[model samples]
Target: MNKIRNGSTVVLLVAVSTIMAIFIACGGETIREVEVVKIVEKEVPVEVIKEVPVDKVVKEVVTEYITETVTETVIEIEEVEVIKEVPKPVQVEIEKLVIVTPTPGPKVEETWVPTGTFVGVSNETYTMSGYAPDCVYCATMVHLGVQESLFGTKRGDAGELVLDPWAVSSWETASDFSYTDFKARENVPFHRGFGDMDANDIVWYFNSINPLTNPDSRNDTGGQMGGTLLETSVVDDSTARFHWDAFAGHTLFKTFTDLEEGMGIFSKKAYDERGEDWIKDNMIGTGPFQLVEWIEAERVEMDAVTNHWRKTPYVNRVEILFVPENATRRAMLETTQAYAGNLPIKDWQSMFDMGFGLAPESIYTVTQIAMSGNYWEYSHIKTGDTLERVRDISKPHVGDPYEGGGTTFDGNTPSMQQSLKVRQALSRTIDRETINDVILGGLGEEHHLGYVWNNDPIWQENADAWSLPYDPDGGKALLTEAGYPDGFDIEWYVGTGDYETQQAVAADWLSKLDVNVTFDRQDYSSWRPTIVARTNSDIFGGCCWGPLLWPFEWTSNTSSFPGGYGIGMELPQSKASFNIKNGSQDQAELKAAAVDMLQYLNDWALFPGVVQQPNAAMYNPDMISWQEMRPYLWMRLGGMRSFEYIQLK
Candidate 1:
């Protein structure tokens, strides 16, 4: 018998032989020569079998037969004795083994080397005003690295809102949330030979932009300031304190850090010497770029600051040209004449197909219909007696637009605007799907509520109840029931750009409901002042006002409330907003107040939202690299691209 072990298996071979006795006594000698042969085989006894323990950590010896190589060798245990039988001989062959070890993974090296000149084009021209830009387009110059505020706010890598240290090093709020103290960074130099920025510069900048302090200063962004900033006091050369009238500490800080409305800190000496006219044409600030030449309504050229305190500009220079024609901008990008440009949705796919980078961002801009409830023609006669009652009950506790001598709809006779049924009927006449698909080229979200984002939890929860179903027949019936059986004539004012096309499409859909509409196409420059001054007494169709940068601003008296500086729509939700602001800071109380305000706005439908359009821009990826674009408090300004972080690939 013989035994051999291979890997996990053990084999045993056994041989047996049978012997027959000779019949004759004389054959006894011959029988002694009996031959042995194999007959039967049997397994070894259980008691004689050696047991191999399971789950034991044993080194495996692998042998390669092809080249007779020993792949692995385990010398832990010595060879055991082999069992043998003399009946026959058996041959055994051995294979050589070789050992092999795994190699480590490849290493990855990543780096971003910044260099080159960045050139971009814009559809709108920059006004380059002294205090505030006439148009929002001029504000993009600050984002282009020419100017910076005391503090900067942006979405961090983790998607949370973060206030980054810029001119301001650190800050803290008061216990009552009425004020915030900011410590300015030291040794931050201003461009164009202005001395370093300090607490004095901070105080001067805010006061210059504040309408209360500098009445001569043209602050188009004053509306977004929320009328909360009372004063800015210089505590010392390195620190400053911002005081507010109400408990608006958080909002006040946000307003200072906001990319659009927030005033950029300027050199007090420069302004005092050069004056407002010179400051308009020339910019001096603590930024990564210095303005070289700014040709009003034509082009702007800036040179990069090589040794900036915060971050040096990667590009040597930045040139922004005003190409109002979309086709011209598109051609520039295609020909590589411009590194980046504002792209229309219709041209986005084509640009992307051509290997250009496409950055699409969600802006605070929404296109909606602003029905002037204050118009005597639309006034609700039935509610004329209750106008005073509504005004008294819904007046806000703070931030009253009427305080600034701004007229509200409170004194207007309540007419059709007071009827919820009429508003709902008018809302139903709008074909949001058609506008989103046709006019916007499928680059928009259908919104149900005004001012509030559709994705917000408050709106999401009550969207169904707030949304008006698109039913022209039902709308016609409702209109007839509201005493306009044959439809009423409305003077529809449509501004230039997307608004012109959108309102035209909407007017077509509204005609199906027997609504008589006359379209008045006007340029944005002319239309903006009219809307801002509340001179558009008739139905003014335009894009929704830019996003109220802060959530609290959404409830500010200037935005959603009547008897306040409203955006044409006279909604009676000011009391709710005021109550929420003055109410207990308790989470539950605030949430309840917010919910009540949202419910009131939804029921009123003061401004019927159409669609939230996406803002898109095209760039050359080979020349530039950037993170995801953000609205950065401005819809038209290409998501506030931080020129400091943008690297040239």
Candidate 2:
């Protein structure tokens, strides 16, 4: 039966092929040849196919062909049968195709080569501490040309404080803010061929100043500034990561970016070979300028670095002379003996009238009567005690109840200056408006709070609550209630500049409360250490300023006046507020906490803010032109003035 079925299938296939061939042969007159293709069926099992290997298959097919001509056509039909074995499946591997293109390198801009010299005069002199800057002013001088920091803060185009890349190219904080990684730009050279900057150099510089790494080198600025940094890890030749136990908010940025007192990256090669003593006297940095000569308190001379990575200075040389006298500094600018010089507020009107260039913005410097909140040193009296004292003592001379009594508080007893009433009394005595208008020659702002600028959003939000009204009567009443029936004798320490005059004006108002004032005049050099150590007398007057956008930077007990120099002597309220602000993850809550802290400081009367000091520099416009100056954290020196930006007109 199977053989019969197979024979019938073969016959059907042959018949179909023969018909297809005949159709092709008759279809065209053009002499064409036709062939029927093979058709295979595996249903039939022939004797040869059945014996085939298991790895292969056998098939049967039939075929036919025909030919035709134009003149005489010949048709032929044929049938053929064949069987073949199919190969088994095999495994193969394929690879994905990819196309790659090379990236173009960055275009290098031409550096500005300076040809002329720029002469500048200032009231202060450089400390000549190359690796370690002693003061903000000295640090600024180093920043001018001799040293460069990893980052710096500058005013953005939108007038907001923004982080600026300097030595480093980019930085990123970890997801949890535990660490920040930084990448150094390629080919950033160090001054005097100390070698190019790399991650190792950065790690060395950070470790050199970090107290955690080198406890013996506990310099004031380095210790306080690098307090938050835990460890620095070198990720690669060009990358470094700084780890912190906890995030310190904006201060973490400020420590590396602050124009003044920020960590300045030094050359690791130079330090190792040159030694610390040599480094202190000499400067090596990748800044726009190189130190040519430093004559201690006389002068400091610097020459431009023609191929500075960031900018080449406009002037070839900068000669900074130590002219402590305000008049000398003014004369230097007027005669073009120097192109620019520091100007006192008393000289502002005269300089402006003479058509000299005056800085367009106010500096962060605030000249205030800093009262000691050192609870350990002074006896603290409470508001209740003051009220009790007021009840016990009758009002002797009463034009206004706020006016102090004729009798003095007990000299034998240690009195509290930290009392809110005492601070209020002291704040009320000095009229800030008069100070701004008269003593400052209408050149300053009447500031009544600490750590907050009048233009700050935080200040704007809580302006009404922060305002300290001038009330001499109220001041006297508070003082009288605080048991200072007349007034107390307090030593007033002051440095040079307008502070002397401002303090004298304050003394006059303070005397109205029968407060005896003993003036201790000292040169700033002699007075600074005492003030920074918190060893200065009852009242010390100086300029203080910080980043306005970050209120906690100045208010934090761990920073600025209260923390760094023991200005408020570790006030518990400030520390608590600082902790809350630092630990808070929400920005709004942090800001609110900062403002609250500032309000608390104000209430505590840690330092009664008198006025925001005006910073002025006189320059001859015909000889030089300067871009707009931004509000600097260090008001004494204008905001990070780059000689690269300054040009000869």
Worst 10 residues of 2 by lDDT: 1-10
In lDDT terms, how accurate is model 1? Answer: 0.50
Question: TM-score of every model?
Answer: 0.69, 0.71
Superposed Cα deviation of residue 118, candidate 2 (Å): 0.7
Q: How much is 457 displaced in model 2, in angstroms?
A: 3.8
For residues 1-649, what per-residue lDDT tens digits would candidate 1 score against the true structure? 0011111111111111111111101101121333222222111100000011111132211121111111221112111111222222221121221212123233232233346877888754433554442222334445666677765655544333344557776666575656678877777888867788899888887776565565544444444444466678999998888886554313533455544344567788877887766665566777777777766445667777776776666777777776657788889888888878776655665666688865422333566665553321122221333222122212111012232233453332223332445566777777787666665566556866665556444455578788867788887777677666776555555432334334443464456655555555443333445444444454554333321212343433233222112344334454445435442333344445656665765665556777764454568887787654322445443333565655666
Clash list (residue pairs), candidate 2: 379-416, 386-481, 402-473, 402-476, 402-477, 405-485, 405-486
RMSD of each: 31.8, 36.2
- Per candidate, the number of residue pairs that clash is 13, 7
> lDDT for every model?
0.50, 0.52
Q: Taking the tens digit of each residue's C-alpha lDDT, what string does model 2 give over 1-649?
A: 0000001000000000011222111111234343332222111000000000111122211111111221211112111111212221111121221212123246467555687888887765433455543222335543465667776656544343445667777666675667778888678888777789999988887766555666544343454543356778899998888886445444444466644355667787887898876766666777778877766456667888886776677878887776767677777778889888777565655665688866433343565555542422111111112221121112111111222442333222224332446667776676777656665665556877766655445666677887778877887788788777777655555433334445544565555676655555444344445544444434665333333323234332332231133342334455445556444434445556666777766765656667754354567788887775422344333222566667786
Q: Of the candidates shown, which would achieve the greatest lDDT relative to the real structure?
A: 2
Off by over 4 Å in 1: 1-115, 132-138, 248-253, 360-365, 373-414, 417-422, 441-443, 486-494, 514-527, 538-566, 582-584, 627-631
Worst 10 residues of 1 by lDDT: 42-51
